[model samples]
Target: MNKKIAASLASIVALSTLAAACGTPADTGTKTGGDATQAPAQKVKLTVWHNYSGDDLRAKAVRGQIDKFKAAHPEVELDAQAIPPDGYRQRLKTVAAANEMPDVFFTNSGSMIKEFYDGGLIQSIMPLLNKQTEWKNNFTPGAFDPLSFNNEVYAVPVNASVTSLFFYNKTLFEQNGVKVPKTWDELLAAVKTFKDKGITPISLGNKAAWLAQSSILSSLANRVTGTDWFLKAVKQDGAKFTDPEFVQALGLMKGLADAGAFQQGFNSLDNTQMEQYFISGKAAMMIDGAWALTNMAATGTKEQLDQIDVTVLPSVPGGKGDPNTISGGAGGGFAVSKKPTGKQLDAALELIYTISGPDGMKAVAEANQIVNYKMDVDQSKVTSLFYKAYNLTKSVTFTPVYDAYLSSQGAEAINNGLQELLMGGKPEDIAKKLQDAQAKSIGK
Candidate 1:
């Protein structure tokens, strides 16, 4: 079955089970236990939807937090439902259209937040944020940029993600006697060294399409022309992708692809297959997000994990850009629906506060050490390489990728264009198409 269909069906089953047990209408208020002489205060049930099905560990961690919230707030019953990550957005859309949205839900901070905000289905969190001093101080500058629309915050960021680096196999590099590259020229030379040593320099699984565009070009563009220019290009304000910087970046990507930097049949391999290639030493490097390290650690041996190292892509020679500029965003966050009542809202806010506060923030960061939250965690718990990547990101200027900054429609177009480009579409054609689509989207 399609992943989206399966998730939607699972959501239906969950909703049905809840309905059967409660025997209450969707909007019916819960009756609290109080004095019979006095009218009982109306109790509200808040539904929360999340997609955290990657592994039992993540699921258990999240459930533990939810259980803690439930034990503290008895009046506001929380109907927490976990959906498959692949089809979560589709299921959320279906729920919204049916007017059965949960009081609070999990969503990405970029175009997804904008869609919910424009539809008036979600509430603006700016007021709540402004009223809370501790919450405001918990985040770093640009941390809320993804959840902001027209200068109003609509969501609270719980975690941060960046596509600034890819993990490489140090053993492979050392065996091949190739030093890690710090410039585009050195990168090309290292690729040749790996090739001469009969090793695949890059393990890129383009079967998923977005992985290539999101994890590679997004960061490369930042390294090529700085974040401001890239953002301007995406926004169609005064920049174009056909300009020297973007064209050069695209050309470099093409050069690498043509030079056999990636493994054979890369376009046919899925993400898991590509990871296996790297883990088993068939490939030397893999372009992926920071989460890649955690996933590998969860399933690989300590020695295997120790062999991996993360670093930002090298700068282009003679390019007017800095190596310290990074491509990233606020990642996933929490948002509440506008239809929830005061008590339910209070409970949801409390839950959000707990999960995104200092303690929870530190836990999440320790789990995925690449996270950019301003929470402090014990350094002993994280790998040295993870700390290296985290500190590198901190010292850089980060910018959200196109999908995290563009409108929903525009983001889809960019994804499609990227796929086309990877499949041999001309760079000029892709640039022209993206620029035209962006202009049309912003006009509407």
Candidate 2:
């Protein structure tokens, strides 16, 4: 996440800052300011894509809003695709290389969105927001900062998120007579104890590559390298990934795998499979994002859900980071393709606002996810598991997610390198891979 998101997140710490419900943007085919969106008199077709493709509650909330938008605007024919996170980026890049971007698409903050903006791949949505003045005013101030570049807003964040947390089965921990770890040494002891009992100490699925980067290593690396040191390294400001502190962080992953912490073939398994391993009690712990809470709330049995509780990744020896913090916040969002105009721009603006606006934000909130909008919610409708995860954010600081802020090449190198590192690759070699990849951009 960016600085603006970090600043805005403090306002949402307890959900107590929330206001009464707000309204959605105006109807389709309406003109406001002179340069504002003007729907075409005839039918308009726009291509749309997003990463909320799984069957999880988070995905349903997003896709549900898209469905409503289609129904409400019959004059617009949307050719939409719901691609999984693993394949979504590459696909968008492929289309972009061919100069064939969709009319509107999903993207994250930091280097990912910056790449598109720098390449002239996206257009400013500021005029569209200016037209919907009331809707624009409702977002937590500074929520739009990450999506704005060169004083022009390009996208709107659908939600803010915490990308790392430890979800442990309380029943398993109690059954085994082991408590949650609060320090590196205690964590190692817990892993050894769980391993001795033939139970996987941690459930992990790294096949998609990102769980290794964003979920596992983001928080772990933060503990070892801290935010300031890491940002300097990211900017190549007298810092490199090959430094001993970052190397020590990479070693932690190797240390976990060597200690029999993760399940077999973790590099090949997907999140759905990992969730099954966790709920079945074969593994006592799972490390994932806040999004998992909603996915669990939707599909988990009440008994199963009740047995789970959330905790932060424990502190490291001589750690430079706070144990309570994790990598996440207002990052990924939606933007229109470069130079969209007339009917196409209108369709694109309406699509993003409808989903990221009041109705969409409320739908996301009801599914137990954090959002940028302020709306009163019925406490009874949200699951206890969600509150457990939600309230955990109150006491901690938030860190930048690795992928959210890293250059695409740097993100790629580490994501793949971590998989290799876990499979017995040397941490030094992997660290150098990132050092080289990032220098390509920052070095210049």
List the RMSD of every prediction in angstroms: 7.0, 12.1
Over the full model, what C-alpha lDDT does candidate 1 score relative to the true structure? Answer: 0.73
Model 1 deviation from native, Cα RMSD in Å: 7.0
What are the per-residue Cα lDDT tens digits for candidate 2 across 1-444? 898977766665334223212323444344667776453354687889899998888789999989989999898989989998888889989988999998889998777888899889999998778998888788765677778888888888887768888889999899999989988888889999999999999999889988878888999999988899989889888789999999999998899999989998999998777887887778999989877777777778888988999989989989888877977767567899985689878888999988888888889888888776666656787877777877787667789888877788899999999999999999999999999999896664
Relative to the unseen true structure, what is the C-alpha lDDT of residue 248 in candidate 2, on a scale of 0 to 100?
96
lDDT of 1 by residue, 1-444 (tens): 999989987896687557757875554334445643232343467888888656533344555677778888867767888887657888998998898888888888777777788888988766577777786776887778778778877777666767657678899888878898888888889888888888898887767556777788887866777777877876777887668778777777877876779887777776667777887788888877666655565566767777888777787777666776666767777788998667667777777776666666766667654554666656687666667677777777765576677665666666677667766677777776666777788882
Every candidate's lDDT: 0.73, 0.84
Q: What lDDT does model 2 reach?
A: 0.84
Best by lDDT: 2
Residue-pair clashes per candidate = 0, 1
In model 2, which regions exceed 4 Å deviation? Answer: 1-41
Clashing pairs in 1: none
Q: After superposition, how far is residue 127 of candidate 1 from its true place, in Å?
A: 5.8
